[model samples]
Every structure is written in C-alpha cells, then in structure tokens.
Target: MSASETNSFRAGRIVQLLFGIAVAAAFMLPIVWLVAGSFRPGSEIFTSLDPLSIGTFIPPRPTLANFGSALGGAFRTGLINSIVVAACTVVVGLLVCAAAAFALSAMQWRGREVVFAIIVFSFLIPEEVVALPLSAIFAQGGLQNTYTALIVPFVGNGIVIFLMRQFFLAIPRSLIEAAQVDGAGWLRIFLQIFLPLSRPALIAAGVILFNAQWQAYLWPLLVTTRADMLLAPITLGLMVGEHTSDYGQIFAASTILSFIPAVVLLGFQRFFTDSVAMSGVKE
Candidate 1:
C-alpha cells in the first residue's frame, strides 16, 4: 500500500478506537457514579461539582454503612417482593407467551394476522394509562396487596409474545414438517423440537420481562399500597419522604436495584444479542 493510504487507514483505526472508548465510558459513568456514591457517606454525595476536585468518582474513605442500612427491614422485604414478582412473571410469561407465539408462528389458523396485529398493538399503549383501571380491577377482585395482584397483571405480556413469535418465525418450516411426518403433534413438536432450539430467544425474553418487572415504579405503587408489597423503585421512592433522608442508604438501595438488572443482562447478554439479531433474519 502507498504511504498516503496507510496513513489514512491508521488515522481511521485510531478514530474508531477513540470513538468506541467514548461510547463505553458514556454508558459506564452512571454505574461508576452509583457504586462510588454507594460507598461514600451522605456528606460526600453532596460534594461540589468543581472540576478541580476528584469529583464523585471515588469514595475518599469507603464504608459498608450504606449496605448495612439497605439490607434490612422494609428494604429487605421490598427486595424479596421484587424478586418474587419478577420470577413469577418470567416463568409464566415463558410458558404462556411461548405457546402463544408457537401458534402464531407454526400453526395455520384463521385470522392469525389479525389476532397478531391486535396483540402487538397493545404494546404501544402506555402502562400509565392502564394503571388506574387495573388498580380498580384488582381492588374489586380482592387481589390488591396480594401476590396475585403483582403477578397476574404482568403475566400476559405483549412484548414477550411478539418477540418470541418473531424468533419462531425464523425457524425452518422443514423442521416442523418433518416432526409432523413422524406423527408428532404440535405440543410434542414444541416441547421436543422448537423449544430446545430457542434457548437464546427464551433467555432474552426472560431478561426483558424480569427487568421490566424489577424496574417498575408506578404500577406497583398504584396496585399495592401495603408497605410489605413494595418493590425496589417504590422502596427507594418512599425513602425520600422519610423523617430524614439518608442519601447513603438511598444510594445503596438504588445500587442494589440497579445491580439485579445488570447481573440479569450480563447473565444472558450473549443470548440477548443473538435473539435480537436472529429475529430480524427471516427465512
């Protein structure tokens, strides 16, 4: 290669590397601040934003005080409730949405497209718009403040159904046909064939559902008024109105809440990427 071309290529490579680093740092800064703030006391969190200072990037003297306060009493109960809600949602969504998606993808039925359109259209509706009616329904049914109130509303998830349907649509029809030729029914085919090949999409959908339920604020706040029924976001929010705000405990609670989603994504990050990418590649 000529020197000019070589120099140009080298410059582009350097530029790309710098841009990648910048993007990564942009995404990581909030998390870094969260961890740093969690370690620092309430005093350090309100540190001046002057450029000359080390800023809030690191704790001057890190302590476990924040974690101690966050992991007990109402906070602990909140965390457990959040976990239970998310777990049940993922499991129910997995089985139900998988079945719904399977029929939408692999079956030949009348009005399939029309049904699918209606289901997918629900995804566009804002959750806040439905929160009030849902609260009333739960209250009327005597489900309010019960785990059923938490689990039932989120179980019929449109996004999960749409995502799984899209993924299933990409599966080779020949596979389903062969299974049918071998005298396998739809249930047998789904259980013994399609589901086994859909690990990535299933994991990805679970991660999405789990994250949604965990980060939820308004819905939990609306339907569940009991203190013990609170989730992470609601718990953190109530801390603000405490007799006195402890930013340290607040930050710690936020950090723990944040960590669950991060760990969930990290746990299934590979599958999540593959599921999204493959869903777009239809045969």
Candidate 2:
C-alpha cells in the first residue's frame, strides 16, 4: 500500500481507539463516582452535590461506616430476600425450562414446532401486560407476600426454554438414538447424557435468571407490602431518599447489591460466552 494509505489506515485506527476509550470513560465515570462516593467519609461525600466533581468522586479519607450502616439496615433484609428468590428461581426454572426444551427438541411429537413457535411468539408479549392480572390472582388466592408469589411465576420462562431448545437441536441425534437402542428411556438419556453435556448452557441461563431475579424491583414490590420482604433494588432505591444527601450509605448498598452478579458473570464468563455462541451452531 502507498504511504498515504498506510498513514490514513493508522490515523483511522487511532481515531477509533480514542473514540472507544472516550465512550468507555463516559460509562465508567458514573460507576467510578458511585464506588468512590461510597468510600468517602460522610462529610466529604456531601461537600458537593456534583456527581462528577473531583471532590465528590475522590475523597481524602475513606471509611466503612456507610457499608456497616447499610448492612445493618434495609440492605441486610433485602440481600437475603434477593438471594433466596434468585436461587430458587434458578434451580426450579432451569429444571422446567431444560426439560421442556428437551421434549421440544429431541422427542418425536406432533405440533412441537407449532408449540415452540407459540412460545417464541410469546416472547413479544411484555411482562407488564400480565403483571396486573398475576398480581390480582395472587391477591385473591392469599398468595401475596408469600414465597410462592415471588418464585412460582418465573419457573416457566419462555426465553430460557427457547435458548435450551436451540442448543439441544445442535446435539447429535446418533447419541440419543444409541441411548435408546441400549434401552435407556428418555428420562435416563436426558438426565445422564443431555444434562451433563448442556451444563454450560444451563449455567449461562441460570446466571442470567439469577441476576434478573436478584435485581427485580417492581414485581416484588407489588406482590409484597411488608417492609422486611424487600429486595435489593427496592431497598437501595428507598435508601436514596431516606437520608438526605447521604451518598455513602446509598452507594454502599448499591455496591453490595451489584457484587453478586459481577462475581457470577466473571466466574462463568467463558462458559457463558461459549454456550451463547454454540447455541447458534447447527449439527
């Protein structure tokens, strides 16, 4: 290539790199402030209301008082509630979604495609549309403020079923056939073979669902009226308004609430990426 072309290419790449960094900084700045703000002593945090100000983002002294206060208050109750709800949702939801996917993908049946298509179509239906009805039903049945109100509704996630089904479709039919030839029933084949092979996809889906459930605010708020029944999102949100100009406690709670998903995603990131990419591949 000509010198001009080389210079042009280098210049373009440099511009792109700078642009990317700028965009990334724009996003990271807020998070930096949030974390930094949490560590700042109460006096330092309130010196200026400007979120991006150096004084607000960087404190001369850092302390853990905010974290301790938050942990002792709403953060404690909310964190426990979130963990319980997310864990149960992952376990039961994964089981039901994976099994449904297996039946849809590996089994010989009529209208399986139609059924799956209907599910796929249901994806377009927003959860908000059904939230009111579900709330009313729960209220009428006296299930409000109960664990059933939180965990039962999410066990049959359509998107999860679709993802698992797509992944299963890429599995070799010969393996399934061989299992059947060896007198392995569908359940045995599924549990022993399919489940083991599909661990990556299972974990990926579980992590996604767990994060969603953990961060859920609206539905949980609507279902339960009790103060102690709060989850992180609602608790942290309320904390923002409770203490006037107390950024430390709010940021501390936000950090704690965000920690779980960050650790989970970091740990399973490789598996999650592989599962998502492989789900698109065909046999």
Q: Would you list the C-alpha lDDT of every candidate in the order shown?
A: 0.87, 0.85
Candidate that would win on lDDT? 1
lDDT (Cα, tens digit) per residue for candidate 1, span 1-283:
9999999999999999999999998888878887888998977787657623566777778999999988975899899999999999999989998999999999999999999999999989999889999799889988878888888878778999998999999998999999889999999999988899889999988988898888888888878888988887887887786477888898999899888888888888899789988888766
Candidate 2 is scored at a TM of 0.91
**Candidate 2 global lDDT:** 0.85
List model 2 lDDT by residue over 145-223, tens digit each. Answer: 8888999888888888888998898888999999989999999989999999998899888987887687677789889
The C-alpha stretches of model 1 lying farther than 4 A from their native spots are: 49-52, 280-283
Q: Give the lowest summed-lDDT range of ten residues in model 1.
A: 47-56
Model 1, residue 207: what's the lDDT? 89
Cα shift from native, residue 3, model 2 (Å): 5.5
Per-candidate TM-scores read 0.93, 0.91
Instruction: Give every collision pair in model 2.
Output: none
